[model samples]
Target: MSRVAPLAPPWSKQDADGINRWGHPDRTYEPLLLVRCLQRHPALTAKLRALGEALYVDATLPPRLRTIAILRICALLECAYEWGGQAAFWGPIAGVSEAECDALVTGADVGWSAEERTLISAVDELEATGSWTEQTWTALGGNLTDEQRMELLIAVGWYRTICTLCNGMDLPVEGWMRPWPG
Candidate 1:
């Protein structure tokens, strides 16, 4: 069961407007777990929504690398709501294979290139120690451009914030999506 149940209708006037703005026109709260749960604080919801959209739209980081890092964070944090949705919806589009997705959950770096392994290691280290080791930073410098490195740091922090929200609320997975493996 979810730790905090999602908001239901008849919502406050502000919340109703927020639902319409952030949710589907059909009145379904299908993919708005984060949005719907925080809609009572419309300002905060809008800011988070904008930040999430901005992270995706920014081209500084390649989507595949970005997705890998995000997935790793999700798995490390054990946030099924975030992990399941990203693995099912975003992974394929970003060229992350099912095997790679599984590896994220299992902490197995098999089948990844040296650079990819380093990236995963960075994510792991960040979760474990709250900072990347000097070795990981050197590896990233060799593989990623300055802009990409910056994007990577921002992306990691961004996804961590998302995982906190998703997990804190125990957001339910979308019906069309499978739950992350136990």
Candidate 2:
């Protein structure tokens, strides 16, 4: 395992409550690891984070594709918390299979649609290579709406950052989750 970063402060009820009630994340809540996310710039962090969730998870992307992109980001970042948190579909919007999800983690394709396969492969390549191939953009760009394209494009960075935060904090995936591939 990689060395863990120093712990930040735990998020308090006040912080949690704010996030829970107001739907605004209090980045400062987790201090033990000194992520100091809150201190950096609340407005900036909040907007960025909100944009991330709004575009990637809550937006119109199919649940399967959304989860695939997210899980792929988790795999790339090796973040159990983010990967594990989305474990049970969290109600509706639950899509995809255990095998498919695992395939994402291992950089393998398990016979998804051309679009599905392309998106996952693109995300993987982006994570591994830092640049996307023209073919990826072409295949995806044609099939996706402008809105979806922008959302997915932004999601690459969004989930990437969120996963890093979870990994840095050593946050585990929710209890019910089974290491993705299981």
- The candidate that wins on TM-score is 1
**Residue-wise C-alpha lDDT for candidate 1, range 101-176, written one tens digit per residue:** 8789986656898888888888888888888777778899997987888788888888899899888877877775
Q: For model 2, state the Cα shift of residue 51 in Å.
A: 1.8
TM-score of each: 0.84, 0.71
Query: Where's the lowest-lDDT run of ten residues in candidate 2?
Result: 26-35
Worst 10 residues of 1 by lDDT: 22-31
Score candidate 1 by TM-score against the native.
0.84
**Residue 5, model 1, lDDT:** 62
TM-score of 2: 0.71
Whole-model lDDT values for every prediction: 0.79, 0.62
Candidate 2, residues 69-88, lDDT tens digits: the string is: 88788877877656755444
Error of 2 at 30 (Å): 16
- lDDT at 134, model 1: 76
Best by lDDT: 1
Task: Kindly report which residue stretches of model 2 are placed more than 4 angstroms away from their true locations once superposed.
Answer: 1-14, 21-45, 56-58, 90-92, 107-109
